[model samples]
Target: MARYNHPEWHPLFAGYASGPTPLTTGSYGQLLYVTEFDGAPKIISEYFPEILEPAPPMLWSHAQGAEINGIGNPNEVRALTAPTFGEHLDDWNEIKISSS
Candidate 1:
């Protein structure tokens, strides 16, 4: 299992990697739509346990207004309310440019 350094509700600034888990069984294949001030990335993992399924989506929404300026301080990411996808993922802060 991968341990997160910050709270699950906190926004993510950088680093786009799957959490620790087995990829063969698809136990951690849950999808996460992480949105940060920089951009948004969809992370899919198959190693994590099913009990932790809620983390990915929550983390994705929590990273709305999070910004990693130049200094090393994690700021609070604000939440947005739009009417496109769903109520949970309405207003997103960052927009994705590429897939690499």
Candidate 2:
């Protein structure tokens, strides 16, 4: 039985059928990036105290001077903070390119 109104994806959902369904702990990763926001950095951590760690992502600014993977760029690093994005949030458009 299908749950919501995802009739489009319904056909894609196939059953496991006979044998036991194999499962693995989602220790993979799921990062919820909150960029281009004016809220306090601590506020985001406080909201999701359990999951979100303090480690920041490797944003575009890091590619300049910051020692990413123990290597820095020859060009001068741009001045940008987590709260202050180099580009506007609206500038980023959703890219849904599927490999299939």
Candidate 3:
């Protein structure tokens, strides 16, 4: 009942005209009986054919002090403005630095 945009639709529809069939009674009986039997060795062999391998160790930096060589080091870096405290004034003339 679906609409198709191309002329190739007729051949595609004829290919799948015969619908799917249900599983056989013997297949269902085998599926049920297989569970009751000791099939762990066959199941394990089929599921996992190869053994797992271990991962490689990671390399880490253990350098203590700054050593700048094109690539910037964090410890060697200095502040743009060094912090200083302003003098506390008790009187107007106490301003030693001239405002002019």
Best by lDDT: 1
Q: Residues 7-97, candidate 2, lDDT per residue (tens digit)?
A: 2221111110111223312121111211123443211110111223322222322212212232211111111211122221111111101
Question: TM-score of predicted model 1?
Answer: 0.17
lDDT of each: 0.29, 0.18, 0.16
Query: For candidate 3, what is the TM-score?
Result: 0.11
Model 3 regions more than 4 Å off: 7-21, 24-100
Instruction: Tell me which of candidates 1 and 3 scores higher on lDDT.
Output: 1
lDDT of 1: 0.29
Question: How does each model score on TM-score?
Answer: 0.17, 0.14, 0.11
Off by over 4 Å in 2: 1-51, 56-68, 73-75, 79-82, 85-100
TM-score result, candidate 2: 0.14
Estimate, for each residue in 29-80, the C-alpha lDDT of model 1 and write its tens digit.
2323243333554342222224433432323323333332322233433322
Per-candidate clashes, comma-separated:
9, 0, 0
lDDT of 3 by residue, 1-100 (tens): 1111223221110000111234321111110000112423111001110112211111112232222122111112122222121211121112112211
By TM-score, who's the top model here? Answer: 1
Instruction: Rank candidates, lDDT, best first.
Output: 1, 2, 3
Least accurate stretch of 10 residues (summed lDDT) in model 2?
91-100
